[model samples]
Target: MYYLPKELFFPSVSLAHSSGIIALGGDLSPERLQLAYKSGIFPWFEDGEPITWWSPNPRMVLFLDELIVSKSMRNILNRNVLKVTFNQNFRDVISNCQEVKREGQNGTWITNDMIEAYCKLHELGIAKSVEVWQDEELVGGLYGVDLGHVFCGESMFSLVSNASKVAFIALVEKLRTENYKLLDCQVYNSHLESLGCREIDREEFIEILKVEKVDS
Candidate 1:
């Protein structure tokens, strides 16, 4: 649990300390935040709490071509009850994610500062949102950053039952259409597992990331 300076570049921090938490107590500036994601690091903190950076050890990710679409999920896909759109409503999606309360999680880590930071990322065309629309209203959505062919999924929320699932399927379809190579899920969870996310070592993730074309 060490602190990092705002002026530090991508090379300043070491990946070997992904578990030790190389940074803590820093402002979520657009440049710092952008650089953080590019280096596979992210911030997570509660309301009124210090900005805490983290890079988990055993990361969760899914190769776009390797998603395990179960038979049941395939049936859900066939129904096509909902339609999906990219960057349709980023503000709404993030707000929803922040408001949707879970039983155990202490309040939301998606604080006001977090919102503004991701909004800045969205403005730069780095962070994106995928909204699931049913008829005329938004039911579910997810947001993340698009780095080259990889989509680093951040958060998702559902207003209606099964809406999140719809959004996810739509996201995969969009990724396929766009020829995406992977979706970095950050961490593992049963919910993501249901949606076909799997685990890959952090080293492996860095290896794949290293080969990506750097944005000019």
Candidate 2:
């Protein structure tokens, strides 16, 4: 296992282990996190564990043009039941994500420190949140770091049925209209698959990230 130095440099993603952890023991400073995302590396670790960096093979991603909206979801959208907004109540969104219970998960990876770190990233305009509101109450939301051409989704929460899905679909539509290149989901799962996110080889994903940048 490789260990990171104090400086904000990471080893090549190719050197990552089969399980995708490339290194450990890096601080979540804004500079480090920014460099990490640019290199297709991200941090994922429990609260008691040292920070671990990963660059998984067969990365999960969504091409904006290929997003799927099912008949039911389309009907739900037609109802105009949920209101979606961006960068509104970001701190509340992250806090709610930290409390959400996930199936087969005994705990959450969104540690307090992680929340603070991402919030700092948000303040710097590097992270963003999607909020779902019903009757003026926050019901669901999602948060992630925006890499200009890509949005690395971190976590989401829903208080009502299909609320998170609504937030995700809205975000996808917004990204598509904005001409973004890809949505870096980072890993594969049935949930993301239903939303048209698929697994692509690491090399291809890295290439897309390189070519998909917007002017700063």
Candidate 3:
């Protein structure tokens, strides 16, 4: 139960305390944010309270080459019904993700400060987005930080059935082509597992990430 220092990061594997609470009371400044992601920790706090950093015990990740694209999903992908793009209309993508409703939650966890902080990370070339559009309308998308050779996925949303899946598939395929070794899902859910994300121990994650050099 220690507060996160200004622009300082605790050990990713340590995680520091119960509730996966790595640290508390840090500004969402760009430098601190970038350092946090690079160390495999990220900020996750609701509005009004100081930013809380976390690095869970079991880290969720995916190896791009190992992604399981089911025959059914491959067929859906082959259809190419949805158009995907990168870094285009980030604000819309993030806003939509924030507004999307999840089970047992009335609203989003992506606060205004969180949005702006990630936007700054985007401007700095660390954060990236994938957008799905149909007939010039935003239907779904995802965003995250490209830390080292790993992509730390933050959030995703879909307006139409399978739209988010489409966007995610497109992004994963692109990462594979780009030679990115890993995709950090951060947390796990049925949807992510269905998309091929899996949980790895913190030490395993840190080891793999350490071997990966953060591309400038």
Candidate 4:
């Protein structure tokens, strides 16, 4: 239940509440966002709510070597029916993520302020995007904060079947080739699990973040 002060700082992840909210009431400045991701915390709050910082107990992550490309996904990649590009159109990618409807959700956490803030991060090259295009039409994509060794994924959207998956798979392969430590999926979801993401203790995740921050 800690509240952030005006200065740029975050409480230890260990201070997070049972719901993974470490603190509240902070602006989404690029500096704050970068520091948050570097320390394994991310902001996720509904519109009209105080900014919420979360560092979930059982953190979901994808080890680059452990990525699973199912048969169907493999076929899709091999077919090359879709084109995947990085940092090509970040605003469009995140805007689509904000607009795409999800089951059991009435609103988007990717609010306008969030979009503008992350767009600032993109301008600084801290936020990266993977876009999926079909005949030059933007169909699906994903965006996230990219630390040198760890990528903290925010959200993704797909207009056509398997579009987000395509974007994700492409990003994973690229990270693998670049020898990234892991992709931080943040919280767990069945979709991420199917792609070989699994939960590890938050302490473990924190330790990795610490090590990667040093190495980078």
Candidate 5:
């Protein structure tokens, strides 16, 4: 296991453990966070735990053109009951993500420090969010780091059924129009798989990131 030093740096993704942890013990400064995403790595650890950085072997991602919108979800979007906005209420969105309970989880990984750090990134335009409004109230939203060509999704929450899905679909549509290459979901979950997210080798992911970095 590698421990990060004071200087901003990360070991190769190839050095990551089978569990995907590359390094531990680093502050979540915007600079470090930016570098992490640019390198196909991300931070994920619970509150009170040392910051753990990971680059999973089989990275889960969504190519912009491959987003899956089910018929039921299409109906929900067509209803127009939910309004979607970009970067409108980042603090609230992330706060909701931190507080919203999840099945099989005792506590949230979005700690106070993590919120504060991400909020800072949001201020700098490196982090972005999508808000879903119902009856003019915030019901669902998601947030992530935006790296020009790739959006690294961090977390999302829904107070109502299909609300988060609305935010995600809206974001995907927006990214598609803007010519984004992919949406980085980091790791996999059934929910993401249903939305057309699939895993590719870390090398493939890293190569894409490299090409994106050069193009941008």
Candidate 6:
């Protein structure tokens, strides 16, 4: 792996490992994060670890048209049990994502620095949050950076069962309406797979990123 410099740049995705780690040891400044997402790279490291950048092979992504919403989830959406909003409480959404304990994970990757950096991006309209509210209380949500044609998801949290799913479905519907080309989940998980996210060659993903955007 390569060591990052003070400048907001990364090595070629072709140089990344099989696991997609492209480089290490960089600060999570907003500029770096912006450039990273724009170039199809992202930072993912646990607290106290050196900032690790990744542009994984077999990139996991969801095209808006390929989204899968189960019949059960469709029924739930029809029931209108939750209200979904955009950018209503980005900080709260990220804080909840940071606090939620997930299976097999002892700690969160959404460190304080990441929270601050993403919040800064949110302030500049480069990051966004999808909030799921239940009876005026925050129940579930997700946050991510908007890279023109691609929305790079960071993290999500759910206080109740299926709340996060509802938020994700809402976000996908909105993205589709807005004509987004892709939803970059960064890595794969069974949950995302169930939602119709599939892996493509990192080079293929990079080619899409190169041609699908309006601007940074």
Clashes of 6: 0
lDDT minimum window of 10 residues, candidate 4: 207-216
Q: Across residues 7-92, which tens digit of lDDT does each residue of candidate 3 receive?
A: 45565547456566787887888888887777778888787777788888688898887677779877877888788999998888
Which ranges in model 5 have alpha carbons more than 4 Å from their true place?
213-216
Q: After superposing candidate 6, which stretches have Cα over 4 Å from the reference? A: 213-216
lDDT of 6 by residue, 77-137 (tens): 9999899999999999999999999999989999999899999999999999999999999
Better of 3 and 5 by TM-score: 5
Q: List where candidate 3 sits over 4 angstroms from the true fold.
A: 213-216
lDDT of 5 at 165: 98
Off-target runs (Cα >4 Å) in candidate 1 are 10-20, 213-216
Please write out the lDDT profile of model 1 over residues 1-216, one tens digit for every residue: 566666755443354364636567768887887777778777877887777777776778877666677787678768887778889799999988999976687688898778988998899988899898889898889898778677888888888777887777778877877777678888889988876788877777767776764433
**Candidate 2 off by > 4 Å:** 214-216
TM-score of model number 2: 0.97
lDDT of the candidates, in the order given: 0.78, 0.93, 0.83, 0.93, 0.93, 0.91
Per-candidate clash tally? 0, 0, 1, 0, 0, 0
**Model 2 lDDT vs. the true structure?**
0.93
lDDT of 4 by residue, 1-216 (tens): 989998999999998999898999989999999999999999999999999999999999999888888998899989999999999999999999999999989999999999999999999999999999999999999999999889999999999999999999999998888778899999999999999999999999999888753332
The positional error of residue 91 in candidate 4, measured at the CA in angstroms, is 0.3
Q: What is the lDDT of residue 35 in candidate 4?
A: 91
